[model samples]
Target: MKSLITAPLLLISGFLFLTLAAARPQLNVLMISVDDLRDWTNFLGGYDGEVFTPHMDALAERGISFTNAHCPSPVCNPSRTSVMTGLMPSTTGIYSNSQWLRPNHPEATTLPQFFKDRGFKVVGSGKSFHHTAGNNPPDQWHDYFRFPWADFPWTRSNKLNYPWTEWQPPPPEYPFSKVEYLRGKDERDWGILPRKESKYDDVVIVDYAIDFLESHSGDPFFLSVGTFHPHLPWYIPKRFHDLYADSEIQLPVFPENDLDNIPPIPRKWAEARRDEMQAARDAGEWEEAVRCYLASISFADAQVGRVLEALENSHFAKSTIIVLWSDHGFHLGEKGHWMKSTLWEEATRVPFIIATPGMENSGQSSSRPVNLVSIFPTLVSLLSLESNTDFDGPDLTPLLANPDAEWSHPSLIDFGYGNTAVRNEHWRYIRYNDGTEELYDHQTDPNEWKNLADHPMYQKVKDNLAEYLPESYTENVPGKNAFVFDPENWTFTNKETGRVVHGRQ
Candidate 1:
């Protein structure tokens, strides 16, 4: 009687009825998460239009693919924390990879916790939550396994000197042919691993996840598979590296003056990695980097293939809801930037797909814009859970059911205090702390190479999109004592010298 979502009854007596507390079948959930995966796939046409994401392409073929999906935040920790907690980085004060939602928003119920509370057995491995200590507390997941770097020979061999700051290549694992030129030698090594599939970190995760799937196939379970690849160091097996050729690699079209007309804040943000892009271009390593990134994508794709195969081969395939998404997008020499933390499309626009077991229009795609923060409510709706978890974005079930349905939700990407981007159906509007703005018509400029904020013709468009920016950016919540927020009037201040900073008080 307590399990409203699942219950069973029995009747046998002549004039009486009996009730039995039996476990009723519920839809199984398989959540696949990737790190730093941009649109450089066979479906998204992100990188040189030659990407080989066959596995992801296959998933998209039968799933509802949102073409304009974006991340809540461009960085890792904040983005994942936001998605898991169903809250925005602005609301939680978790705006960077160094910030964890568990400590910042202690009382918030996470996605996994919600599922566990609703009588679903939750199991996860690898990078599901924000890294240092996952965004979800240990008690949330019935079974939580964090795979170690030392568990994989390839990762253990090339250990980070500081691990967090630098990578130190010890002895070669098995003579993997590596890229000749890499800008950040420590963090950008690309090569092939000669060891068996079990020696890779991602493979280990798949193995654990597959076993979990087999064990909990009958019961209602929430299984998560997180893959860390195409992220950095591009260390994949030689076979995957061979899938992409240096000559076929196509660098993003980054005009020398692409940032010339943009506002100073956004321009300065992209310029943060200007030197890295310049070094690659000058040394003719740009294509090599792209090739490495492409190979990493393929490698991650293969992992997807393995997991999906495992799911399909199991008993819970048809009765499962599969949701695959990346924490945020990545930049492969786009706008003179190498990694995320920018509000541009390259850093925010991500690949998102959902496959409900028996949906009518499963394989179609939607151009309507959606953000990662919506995944929580979307799944809650899909699973039909009765929980009142306040979410910043709307449930995407309608978009999934009908790709062409009316969707008015604009995607929000919060990078830091007073820096955010609002992406709608055809326009992207950005407003910085100094009141400067950048507007891009995605219809005309998908690459975002041109800045039309100064154009007099688009004043109304800017005004319409700017209305969706976060009501109040709590503060930049990553580092220590960098920003102090005054909630009275929604303003930030410099704590060091007690000076009112970013935005008007």
Candidate 2:
């Protein structure tokens, strides 16, 4: 009798232990961010010519890709701030790169801090946050590796004590492109850097991330790895540039009257960078510039491949979740623009992919429009953490389970104070601060060449999309000039008001 009772008790205890472990299993997160990467990968087909991004393509094959994902704002600071804080630009008032995020909203919980608060070892490297002073606070992460800005040797030295400006120029072979107009220009130029791939900063950044993944032994971790490539001064190793040397470079279609029907505000935004576009065209460097961009994309993709390989080989492979996204899209002479900061598809549309362990619908894509702001809440739900009610976006778990789930929320893109764009499955509607409107039917005009906002037939469509816009706009936050920040102390002093606010330490 005693032997039988002891055997049944042991079985019951073993079953209870297994059930508890299954209920709350440890889940790790690996988030990869690429800067200025648009929808030009082999998966998205944003580029017309042949593009090589095997690593990202392979990751997409094993993950659920959101084909219609967009950023909360087209600019860097606001978009990244939205992703970190789970707040939109209209709510946070951080509309541009110059506006610091911590000074404006210090009480908000960042994505890293959320995980860190819940006993996760949160750490990251590279341009995970806006690469500006006072933007990336110390309290958000248990550990972080700041980006090495000295990698780019051509930029101007910061004489005015500005952020990310103190850098020495390279040796005599400075402007490798040798384009006449791009001779002295810093960020606009691109060429082959005469160096080994190991010396590159992105490679270094990935090395740090890989080291962490291989050696981390503790509670579950949230590892963020960001790469600043294809953003500006598109310099990469010679081998990467050589990969595209023999291929035919196809530039984006720039119609003669592309800006004819745009409103004044966005029309000015497009025309703002027209001189850069024209200079490249006149110098006959258009194809070379596009090639450099594609090569940079390939280089970034290689770094991504390295990180993925590290994760796969690690002991945490089966329990980790991988997510890859770009802060915002890039505009390579699309719609008469050279870079981001426009509300058009070229600047707003980005590559978003998420892969979780044991996902039934892995390797599928969702056409439903989504925004990056949902990252925080979705992670909360995925990790079974306590939910925060202040997230501006909804949880995307349903879409993760079923790619074709009924998702009604369209992706919203905000630029300035009142400039907003609404993108759905078939239409894109823009409303400027001056109340001017522009609408394009993606089914017919994927290029957004024609503006149907003036057409009386699309009034209902405009009104229906317009209802999704923000009802009230938050005032612009204080610009960089408005405060004197002390990085060591993590404090901000208003220039005019002389008010001191303690930042995250």
The model with the greatest lDDT is 2
Among all windows of 10 consecutive residues in model 1, the one with the lowest summed lDDT is 13-22
Candidate 2 at residue 280, lDDT?
84
Kindly list the per-residue Cα lDDT of model 2 for residues 1-505, writing each as its tens digit.
Answer: 0010111111111332243247548789999999999998998999888888999999888889999999999888899999987788998888998898776666677889888888999999988988767888878888888777655744746432335456665667766666666666657778887777897889999999999998999899999999999788898998899899999998888898898888889878987777877888898888898999999999999999999999999998888889899989988887888888899999999999988876667789999999999887777767766644366777787788778988899989999999999999999999999999999999999989999999999999999999999888888988988988887787888888887877665
**Residue runs of model 2 more than 4 Å from their true location after superposition:** 1-24, 159-166
Clashing pairs in 2: none
Give the per-residue Cα lDDT of candidate 2 at 250.
Answer: 84
Count of clashes, each model: 1, 0
Q: List TM-score per model, in order.
A: 0.84, 0.93
Model 2 poorest ten-residue lDDT run: 1-10
TM-score of 1: 0.84
Residue-wise C-alpha lDDT for candidate 1, range 380-406, written one tens digit per residue: 766656655557778787777678988
Model 1 clash pairs are 192-238
Whole-model lDDT values for every prediction: 0.73, 0.84
